[model samples]
Target chain A: MRKGFRTVSGLTAALAVTAGVGVTTAFAATTTTSVDFQTHGFPTVAAQAAIPAGQGATIKAGDATVTIPTGTFSDPVEFELLEGPLSSFAANAPSGQTPVFDFAFKVVDQKTGAIVMKFQKPVMFSLTNTDVNANSMYYNIAPTGTYTLNPVKATISGDTLQHAIAGAPVGWVVTSPATSVAQTTSPITGLPFADWLFVGAALMIGGGVLIAVRRKVS
Target chain B: MRFAGRSRKQLLRSLLLVGGGALMIAGALEIGRIPLAYLRVARAEQTTVSKPLVKVQIVAPPPAKVVSYSVNALYPPAAAPGHQPVTGSLMGRLEIPKLGISAPVTQGTALSILAVSVGHLSSSVLPGEVGTTVLAAHDVTYFHHIDELAPGDTLTVRTSQGVFTYKVVSHQVISVGTNVPNTPYPSLVLETCYPLDALQLVNQRYVVRAVLVASHLTPSSAANQ
Candidate 1:
């Protein structure tokens, strides 16, 4: 019974140490990964989601200098935003101002402009920032990532301009005429799977060492 | 004393068995909730607070591989009595060749059943013809991105007869009320309570209004014509 208890204690101690290491390593990884800049004045919510299966996400026009908010990427990608409703209003889509394509941007990046990480694909998306119901049930299209689409200019897909004249607010309708439309990867990319694994391993080894030495002394 | 010999061995085995079972259960629960919890968390940020009428297909299970739901169709399903004929003169189903958003549009304001459902049917007050095609989705769920739209953003509404594309011109935030429900304007009116969790009607609403630009009658209509 004494031997059994000792073994349990040893294992628990080892696990505790590992947990500690895992935590530290996780923090280290989080810290080392840098953020060049994030100016999400228009509500920081992810809109337009699709599984970036084979073809990957079509880079929206305004999001030229993309960064992987959390995960890692396999390579650097380049593409234009879709031309339709979502395509034309890339950076400023999440706003309430309407009818006119009067847009302004606060462009910021790292001082060095070294955007190493990128968000290659989004498995799902929602354009609504407030309606939880809409986010869950509204017009959601599944991902068609295996597609290779050519970069089309924003003007071609001009659907928003059409909505303004006939459908806008009572006084809000645009009486004037108009038209328009418009992540990451590193070699050791932030592939979420690999990142978590690296964290787990370091924790186990380091924790094992601490528990082993402590047992000898006690 | 003779029975005592086997009794000790049995007790030891039982203890080990019980201990192992407890630990295993704890581990499984931990794994199970990780994903479920993620969806709940994502709900805070990504959730659409619209009417909960749309169908949800649970593709992923617990441990939250479930990130987002896919929109199969937008309009409400047809009823038994020969799905109500869409109100007003028919326009073609709205189709945006770019974003791939295609849905049938009817005359008047939108119905809750019409908000985020399979499709938008004609409304009673405004009718689906040309005036207000008010689309009322639950504020937080489907209409969450309505806040993201600035003026000039475009949306296409396809009627049975023709296709019309509209641009956003203005927006308004109003408290949701049964008395003065906001429906489709001369454009697309996407409105919802501001925070979505506005149980007390405390939060102000946020609205996005857009205008219609081009109305194209597709050749597909001629084939049936």
Candidate 2:
């Protein structure tokens, strides 16, 4: 479902309005969209600006900046940029990827009332790095129904993650792709020794109870 | 001392108590074996031996579109073309020659799967791939002796994809959430609950990292024969 980008306070009302618009109307519009950032426990900072077809616009959210080049979109669009903490997606992260920063970008067609997934030309997106790994790589959460980290070729120039993208509606994550494994959960819940102790206790108690019952019957 | 003077109930009760006590002691001994084994072989000593870097030859599989949040949804289908594996499906067998461990490795790290066999973390690259392939098991079972695996020891993995040999590079016992350091080479990481003999849940994990030293792909191995 597509909803016009709004501030954190108005996010709920906007989503409610979109839900009321029904499926047919929503599909008739562009289907390209990102999950509501606030809904997913992401930081509540979003910026939106309308860029007419054949024109370019620059939008900034927090320390991140996005530049849409002229003729990048064949249609007039409203650019949306949202920023949040990378740790929010820790559980969903691809193994071995330690994410330090996160961003979500979406493009909505102004006239068609739909989100834009592809671009006529590429756009430049950059973020002023904060505690980002120097050896980190750019990855986008592929909407393949799972949280797949697709490496995006990017360069770091003195505390910045700058990269070019062919489309919007991407969940951009910067992660250090080192480490063969990160064991987050404890693996041993059932120990053989513990099981044995329980078994022995049960046997001893059962035997003692039977001996007492026999003496009473006699 | 006289069995003729003892009643049937008394005899039965004595047998049960003695039998249960013996069984409990046996269980304690089983748990004691883990620490004893560790003492015989020292905790992984950091060796400074410089081994030649082995070239990674196996081409990593193309990025599969499988991404899942649930434990059951994590695994890719077992050697099936264009299919995702079901959780607990057999992926391969892991062998540690030094420790005499040969255990089946399953796909996902579900408790049910780890209780019986080594479980592969779903998000890692498969064995012999360019990235790290992570496998884990319960310390009570396949990984009880992992602490005895010192640097320079060799371990082999046989999979449908190929046969791979990795040399142990380092071992560390870290807090549960700390990440295993990234390596520039193709690596394999084995993890189990720490303190191997802990009778209850622990907050640390024992990790063993190894680099790929040799590999024999299925096609090449078959052709050589």
Candidate 3:
């Protein structure tokens, strides 16, 4: 009886140790950040200033709001402010074959701290005009290199005008606030915690069986 | 006493069970590790701009440098009523009948644009123009069967201005430093990374060259004629 009790206790202790290790390792490997934008359209310069690396930011303007999760930017970035009708600017005016509003901005590099690259490429934004009187505006920029934007977490509140990036689709609606888009990632890539836990459980069961068989034979 | 007195068969079974468990764990780890590596490589490739296989200076051909050829004579440069300068917009649709490929042609080679449709190099001339209209796309997706194209294959491009058809002149697989031949007449160049089956970063490109054969303005534009 004593021997059996000792073996059971030993196996329990071993199982506990493995379970604790697996849980700790899993948590250490995963990191996440969520940002909520309470406003619609572009974020104000003052609001942009408060955004930190790997932190979420919510842009709320009127009834429209956009939520951007942390890790979207590899480094700190400043948003170029634009007000009034977007088409008023000759440069921002729609031209060429596609008559979509095109905007340009520079991503200020946090390191060496210079504006290393200019995002002159037009990022297509879909506008949902719920209010006919509301002025329409869009701020589009693709920040490459150190100021890389995570397209996965980047989303908007409007009808999707076009699908851009791998996961994030560009949405369009004149409405103030809507669930424009969302991004999903593979949980396995973060950490195979479930697999590790399974392995630990298997080991405990296998060890228990071996001990029981050995004791019975003796 | 647990193993010393045991039969050989029992001992062997115990050893096999332990070995099998270890192998299972190792296999699981390997399976989980490989996908992570592939994801890393794919992400890196998309983010970094890979050097072009051909080293031709990207120059926007002057508007006045028109090429006079028998083919151009057939499709006179009438005023394409709605023709506008290419500005990274959807210029047209590219179709290779033999390959049964039809994809939208956009104005820029930005990754965001290329992710959805073929990108027309902004520096290159537009279709029906007097220079090369360069187009690029991903190998594994839209242009996977590009290798199947041969001399004499037909490529048709439809734009807001007009519809242009071309005949394949030749194909080349060149390294990043090689220069694509410059022809005096309007041509079409389709480019993608070489080794269609490769999953790693490719250093060479498969380029298909085709010369203009026919062209016609869109019906609305033709009405102005």
Candidate 4:
């Protein structure tokens, strides 16, 4: 009975340490920022055709009440896009694919079930563009009530996707208020594909060694 | 292999060690799906202001007839019509039946997702409408696919409004600022990097001018008849 008790205690301690380390590593990666209108490039409507009445959007998250802003523009035909939270937008992003985060969407008004606008090209958003490599979501709400989102975490290296997609100096600079955060059901944890690999390797080696030593003693 | 003459205590240790290790490794692998964003462009996207030029002809449909609402509430805060949200994006998917180039299109040019990629312009390019509806697309992403396009390529724009079909009457690459002179026919103008991926002074701007062919404007048709 003592031996069984000893083994169970030892295993419990080991498991706690391992899981704690994983959580700590994850906390170090997720960064958050409080972005205002200026941080997001305020749009200017040079010219636009008049659009009649349209539905707007409202985002409800945590304690923050997020609403769309009326941007500055020169044209009376200006259109307004009220975006929801980045976390809520979805896209067609597949891992291990070149040029991740395809932003293609049809304009829909939940009330009408009507398709107002359709995008022929894919607006590509990359999570690996800044420091957080994982699936990240960004929302762009058009005045016509169309929501286009890039909804996947992908491996984006170098400026190929950035330059090719933006057609100009391109890439998103993420500003997180918290340098890092605890994992809150987010798809990605802190660290890269290599970090976990190292932990696994260590566990395997330690387990093997402990097993070997026990046999010898026996 | 070490199962020989083992005491119960020794056996317990072995099991805990081996079993715990396997579980942790598998869990670690499952956690490896996240991506990292470390690389940056270092420099911002380049935008060169062109010198003021001459007045040009306007062919696009008379600015769409929108019912004017004087109510202050009609225009909500953070609302900019035709304004595209700023995010890391390039090519938008395009399907112009007239243009054989039915694939992903980059956002700079007006034709495909230009407004979505660039500004608030999606509502402007109505297919089969009376006036010329201009659409610009990046020459590189979807346009590179156009390098493979010939004169006879048919272009199509499938929007929430409906599917618009056009035929490429003429295609040319001009300077970035060269706007067509004539009020011109109702058409779709697609722009992109002139020669494949030419980073040089936009070496040339490829313009595909397609006149309206047919449209699936059923809602209006149903409303009229």
Enumerate the candidates' DockQ scores in order. Answer: 0.01, 0.10, 0.01, 0.03
| DockQ, cand. 4 | 0.03
Query: Which digits, one per residue and each the tens of the lDDT, describe model 3 over residues B6-38?
Result: 676577567656765665555566455435444
lDDT score, candidate 2, position A150: 43
True contacts kept of each: 0.00, 0.21, 0.00, 0.07
Using Cα atoms with residue i matched to residue i, what is each candidate's TM-score against the true structure?
A: 0.27, 0.43, 0.36, 0.28
lDDT of 1 by residue, B1-225 (tens): 656756765565555455545444444444444344335434432332221212211212211100111110111111011122444322224333434434333332233232322123233222122234454433433454566666777776543334456677777755434212222123455445565443223335565565455445435422221
Task: Tell me how candidate 4 scores on lDDT.
Answer: 0.32
In model 3, the runs with Cα more than 4 Å from the true position are A1-218, B1-88, B219-225
The candidate, 1 or 4, that scores higher on DockQ is: 4
TM-score of candidate 4 to 2 decimals: 0.28
Report the lDDT tens digits of candidate 4 across residue range B1-225: 345545666667767667766755665554442221111110111111121211112233323221111111211111011223222233133474433444432222332233123211233333344324454444333344565555567766543334556666566766544443211123555555566555332445565656555555335321221
C-alpha positional error of residue A54 in candidate 3 after TM-score superposition, expressed in Å: 90
Residue range with the least summed lDDT across 10 consecutive positions in model 4 chain A? A21-30
lDDT of 2 by residue, A60-123 (tens): 7545688888998878877767655343554466666665556676567877766665566667
Deviation in angstroms for A72 in model 4? 62
lDDT of 3 by residue, A1-218 (tens): 11223332232223211112111001111111211111212222212233455555554322223344566455565532212211122222222111122222223445434331212122222222222222232322211101112222223344322212111111121211111001100000112334554665666566556555544543
What are the chain A TM-scores for all the models, listed individually?
0.18, 0.58, 0.29, 0.19
For this target, which candidate reaches the highest TM-score against the unseen true structure? Answer: 2
Residue-level lDDT tens digits of model 4 in A159-216: 2122111110111222111121111111111122345556656766666666566566
